[model samples]
Target chain A: MTTETHLVVAVLTVVAVAVIVRMVRRGVLKAKYTVLWLTVGLVLAVAASVPTLLDTVADRLGIWYQPTLFLMLAIGFLLLVAMHFSYELSRLEKRVRALAEELALLRGPVPDDTADGGATGDGSG
Target chain B: MRTAVIIPAFDEADALPAVLAELAAHVPDHEVVVVDDGSTDGTHRVAAAAGATCLRLPFNLGIGGALRLGFRYAATQGFDRAYQFDADGQHDASQIPALLAGLDDADMVVGSRFSDDRGYRVGRSRGLAMALLRLLVRRVTGRRFTDTSSGFRAFRRPVLEFFATEYPMEYMESVEALVLAVRSGFTVREVPVVMHDRAAGTASNRNLRLAYHFVRLLIVLLAGGRATGHTPQVAR
Candidate 1:
């Protein structure tokens, strides 16, 4: 049972990494920005294959009890999920800004992003 | 001289008003170009209120990205000189005269806190890190720069063009500017200036992380300052 579970997890991990790399190459994501996320994923995948690795990390961090395999997997997944949401939020924000700028232009710059260049009564420090 | 002061502001609304006021009082003849690098605060309103020519970057590109945009604007607008002024109120506007005066002999003039009696305080680790940086700059550029990471500096047209095309868009703009200037056979001079602690906003780096950035810059600098094609002569 243990051997089968490890094999399944390994296959899934490889597929996930391959997908991420493909997405990065296709410009769907950026490699530099995704390094931390990819590293967390890879570390979790490797740790899952070797149960003893948890003891070493736990000892180094001065944690008393050995962390459960499920907990480790959950924590790693949470981090990667957070990263995904961050990237998505930034992308959405960019799209919104573009839309806002387009709307402002169509409306002939009615006190939006383009209202900055004119003279104003506000003085400097 | 037609000068443009490039102020890269990141959520610096609280401190910028005072800095802009000082600039107006001291360097009013120069056109101010505030590069608002996607600040969430009312930085754009403050800059606009202060009557600065603003360049709103769509995202929070780092300091290098902001400065490169500023340099490009300066080049296109035909400014004779551009000064990189910090938005955090640490740089003194009163030193603009000394910086501009030094520009006659050198292509770029750097304002150094250690060059005068003015004392700037940070964590002890930062001081050690800057000492390491001074060593690295001495080794790499063959010039003794007391503060290689100070953002308070002025660049003439030639140095402005060099940065507009080849400025590395990261945290290493101060060091990279010095290296690029030296590599391009441009004379660089350091002048006495007062540096104060920032009035508002926390620094992005704590002590240990600050050391990490210094080490990162040294590695980038030692990698043979040639990748950006800013240097005319190939490293031997």
Candidate 2:
């Protein structure tokens, strides 16, 4: 609840929100992803402004230190963001595989008379 | 049915010419596709010079990715069967007929090296890994497979289409693909085939990498589910 700590938190929150908004406006960050970052920034700002709210929540959770609570929440938020990135990575990997398959097939030879003959047979020699 | 031989090559410039030659001599009737998996050598040129239809990937996509592309080509080009062969010259092209013969009753036919004691021996580590995979696949599919990691195999049209849509892009895709096939209601069989040591180029799996790959593949096979939803084609 020190004045200096409050000033630092306020500045950091403002910078985070401004950067996120600028990225969103430049289309570098999609709206869906921006929402998560925006929420994190807003929560930090609110927690920093209402210093007593942090102490009350920490007391209810049986934590002696209020900063630890903030630290735990920040860590949990980061873990969720990391999990979301992993899901996005998995999806992109699948799409890349599909695209690679399509590109290779496009580069292959056209089906011809021999291909037709091969298709009609019993495929047993 | 029309059959195409899909050879997935990665930096096999030294061995591709002879492999293509043997394939041309042994199975000239079948369409041959050499998918050059972003080799930094003359692999594409060698395949093209040998008269095999060569598809060069812009970058390396490993064996699984290359084979998936082959399946896509087979399915889209209306091939009735697609045969997977290795460009390392380890797979015998002459055994392709036996694979095709097995296709008469099965949706997928694997050219197994251990089915009839063809005398193909692996190192202790690889043997143990293969044994574990065989047991896992047998338990999952209720059918025993002697060579679950064999790259040489043949697939019917429906199986080709299924794999073209979805396949494992992992270290042990060969074994995983078989599990996928069996789980998707496709009949799978194995035929004995002789294999040779690589004519050239070092194996992608070796030493520390092999150990890591074995662990990773074990986890993936144990945790993964069926990869496709296509119903098996009725027996011809």
Candidate 3:
């Protein structure tokens, strides 16, 4: 119930809400990415409210202080961004290939009158 | 034959009314569809007032994306031919007849400024750049085009379908369409035509930026393939 603890809780609450809103807007919040961001946001919010949990994790990971915990958070955000970019790149390649196939068909040929007649059973072939 | 001219406009409200007027005067029978490529300016209103069917994109999709939408409309709406005309008044709409005339023999008839020994208004450096592009395109596709970069061209039904599917979003390297058509055994004829300087905005790709594009396009074409022979066309 200290003044600094109250400020940390307010800031983390605001960040968790902002990240949730962004995820919702991008439509990635519905699936695995959403769950991951939500978990991180929730954990950070709880750690702000109860600072002892931070010291317990720090002790378990053999970290001397909470600054090392901050580094883990930064790495998690970078991993998420990299994963999103790769997904977008794969989607673009599939789109390009589909387009190329359409072009191949349209530019194929005008069916010949002879083939049309033969296929229709006129038997000129 | 019913034809629709799709003029893709991007912040060219100043020059569009004049171009629409010229199109109406020379080719009154053809319908004009102007796709405003997400212009912040009042391009849609101006185009509609000037008597063109206006389709506004939600955002700027560049020239190729706009043209693909236009072509799809032309195909589904039952237009016999679809022609792409620029909004800056650089292309001469009077040459519409020649493009239509060559349509029977070719799937697409491109307006080439260098076709019949015609001169260019572009400077010496730009002129040389175009010459090198023609040579590079020739080497890659085994075909030479006078104005590989000209936006003034007409497409028959099949070419219309071809572009709707796989149109390049970038500007530099769309000659893939022409190369793909030839590979699929479609005939592409280059017709001689005059291109005027922009009446209102500047060229989309100008000067050093333009030169860089040709070099980049050349690399793509060379890397794709140089093995060229006749792709036999099925007789219709």
Candidate 4:
């Protein structure tokens, strides 16, 4: 790898780590999710700083280009994150639907369904 | 046994009044609950004025979500049976008794427009879509449903409770709900009823929407019914 390429990767990894830390501090991102981002950033930094490590791994895997190995790893990491988010989203959707049902019930009866000639002032309008 | 009529209405202020009036006149003994699906107009007020219970959703959850809310209300309120009626005035209130009567031998009763030699006109595209859905449902459930998309239906307590907890929140929920009901070991029967066109406003099903709905419903049914562990409770 060129010295300039190494420098770029190092700077990008540092920036990502800084951003994740800021998000965690601001409570925009939870600590649990931040761990995943931090690990990803640290792995990128390690691979970029030690190009020989990437080269050996790529050679063992019969890859002609070492950079392609790094690209593949980054893609794999992103795919994992996306799948995790999908599962979280599915859970959150179910919770939201359940909450909505509860809220509707709490809002009280529609006038005709009630027994006492319709409760006049429940603010259901 | 107590019964609740669940009407899920979205922006149907013009049409809802008459439907509610018909319910009040014909089915006064039953409880009428209109789920106002976050209409921008006076749907909630109209339903209230017509002496129907109005459950106002904060936003539009579409027909499926609104009906689920209605089901939840019915189940929680200790209703023995629940009927799904349309706010667009397409479903005849007078036929509700027949639907409930048809429920005597089944867990769920569907008011089918194509049953009992009842002639209801359908557009070419919609007729074709209904035919395809009928074929798919028959293939999967080993039962023939002449009108799989009919919104007018009645459900006994167990089926109502099941749908209250889990229902398809998508475009063609009626079709999907049928699949779910039959797959979950609930018997569904169809009774012929005369259905009229919307008294006011337009239906949401246009050419493009119908095409999209057909593809989506086909995918959902083909993917198999939703995995709801709803064991049928003993009927009351």
Candidate 5:
């Protein structure tokens, strides 16, 4: 990582952290999501500040290309996050569907009294 | 026994009037409960005008979701039995007695179109899909169901109560609900019944979406096991 690029990454991560903190104070983001984004920001800041950190880790993994490790990690993280999002979306949809059903049932009326006479006779009619 | 006809209508104002009229004529004693699934067309108004109980949803939930709502209402209203009647004029009101009579021996009765030559003709591809679904349903439930996708069905009180909450809220839910009822130790039987194509209002045709839902149903049947366990009364 070049020093200039590292400086940019670090600055951007700091700005992101500041924004996240502000959102937290304003209660804009849910705690779970705020924690998720803050953890991501923290990891990016650490990686930017320590240029050799990634390289050392890459060497231990026996990868000739150090950036490959970073790319792999980023891709894996993103895939997992995307899967989590889909799971959350499915759950939310199910809840909304249940709520819709409940609403309809609440508004649903009692069947008319015409069945009163029929209940007495054989339903063959 | 109080029998409720649960009609799940979605923008079927054009078709519902005739269907409800036929129902009232054939089974005057059976009260009808129509669940309007967020229709832009005043489906709710037609249902209410029919002198039937109507429940209007705030937004569109698919057929399965709408049916679940209808079942929930029927069960809560102390209905002893309930049968699903199509709002699109596809189900035969004259067949209601036959369909409901099956309930005497079984907890759930499916009005099968293919059991007799009476199953209205479908395109070749749809026929093939129907066959595959029947095979899979047979495998899943270890019981052969000639018409796995038939929406015309009747359920005894226990089945209605069970389905009030646990009914599958997805496309091809009829098959899932069939397997669910069987797995829950409820007796399910199929009766030969004639069905007609929609007399009015067009089917919301989407080949691609139907294909996707078919694949999803396959995966759920194979992996999730339509039984999803005997957990009682949990709405999904």
Candidate 6:
């Protein structure tokens, strides 16, 4: 059972667009990443709707296997996204560490985790 | 000169009481600041009862983080100098004056155990690693150091204030801090000092973690990290 490349990619584009829209509407994805996935969706939409677009581009690039071009581009894009995520994660970790140190400095030698501070407060009402 | 002893303790309650007592007996004029590294034990109470100003961290941020807080506290309180002493009683309080005496000539004094025949022994691989680290330190800072990881060290007000915010937060931070200070153009010296075996509690040395941190430190040393600490903010 052989499936045509256009049909497969078309189905994938529909599913990807639906999932991306749902995720964005549900507020699960941040605006920055939402823009990223939306751009990915738009590229997929262009490739699927204009069935000859990938073939035309791949042909111009002299790639005999059109799907190879798609796969290569996808892999490259994913690698860049992964690298960006790693950079962001390192930055966030540093900020969080700084916050932890700041919190410790502000809390002083005493810990307000216990109910003692609240209990001693004027709860006369 | 106003001096502070920065003791970073994590579950060393058994040994800390004696350590604090010795510090009090030996260096009465020096203020002691104990950083309780989120110990589940009553380490804060031990430090407080011993008349040491204890800063209890919300959670364990490792030894580097604890010392940073202690340094920050000491600097903000206007202490002219500070020395780090082990909470396990491995560090002798009598030698504190000798450590501080080094401040007369250098901005930072590292109490190196290998400077003389102090008989401090480690495993063969660990010794190799330390030797490699010593080489790396010498290469990066353009200076020689016999011990790169000795916790027994002292710093003047300028260096203490500098480390208040810029101390490395990594596991093996002493070496990194050493490199940072030297790279930032501060004078550093290593002096021979005698340290004892822990009177209580096990040393926190895991080969796996140590090896991992060793590789990370190799990268840090070779990679030319944030070495721009030569700001004019710190007064001479």
Tell me, by TM-score, which candidate is best: 5
Q: Candidate 1 at residue A38, lDDT?
A: 78
Per-residue lDDT of model 3, residues B131-206, tens digit only: 8777877876788787777778888987787666545655653575566666667788888987786533276646
* Candidate with maximal lDDT: 6
Better of 1 and 2 by lDDT: 2
Residue ranges of candidate 2 with Cα displaced over 4 Å: A1-8, A108-125, B199-201, B224-236
Q: Give the range of the ten consecutive residues with the poorest summed lDDT in model 2 chain B.
A: B227-236
Q: Candidate 4 lDDT, tens digit per residue, B1-236?
A: 99999999898889888888898899889998989887888688778777788888877878888898899889988999999998888898888888999889999999999886767888787788889999999988899989998998999999988898677887778888998899889989999898986533278756687788789888777887463322223122
Off by over 4 Å in 4: A110-125, B198-201, B206-210, B225-236
**Model 5: which residue pairs collide?**
none
What is the TM-score of candidate 1? 0.65
Q: For residue B179, what is the lDDT in candidate 5?
A: 82
Worst 10 residues of 2 chain A by lDDT: A116-125
Per-residue lDDT over A63-89 for candidate 5, one digit per residue giving the tens place of the 0 to 100 score: 887777777888998998899899888
Worst 10 residues of 6 chain B by lDDT: B227-236
Looking at model 5 chain A, report the run of 10 residues with the lowest lDDT sum.
A116-125
Q: What stretches of model 1 exceed 4 Å from their correct place?
A: A1-125, B225-236
Query: Per-prediction count of colliding residue pairs?
Result: 2, 6, 0, 3, 0, 0
CA lDDT for candidate 3: 0.71
lDDT of 5 by residue, B102-217 (tens): 99999999999889787488878889999999988888789999999899999999998888778887777887898888889999999999888753326655788889988988
DockQ of every candidate: 0.04, 0.23, 0.03, 0.36, 0.29, 0.27
By lDDT rank, best first, the candidates go: 6, 5, 4, 2, 1, 3
Which pairs clash inside model 2? A118-B1, A118-B2, A119-B2, A121-B1, A122-B1, A123-B1
- Model 3: lDDT of residue B165: 51
Model 1 complex DockQ against the native: 0.04
Q: Which portions of model 6 show Cα errors greater than 4 Å?
A: A1-4, A111-125, B198-201, B227-236
Listed for every candidate in order, the interface RMSD values in angstroms are: 11.2, 10.5, 16.9, 6.4, 8.9, 7.4
Ranking by DockQ: 4, 5, 6, 2, 1, 3
| Per-residue lDDT over A50-83 for candidate 3, one digit per residue giving the tens place of the 0 to 100 score | 7677667777888875656655766877798799
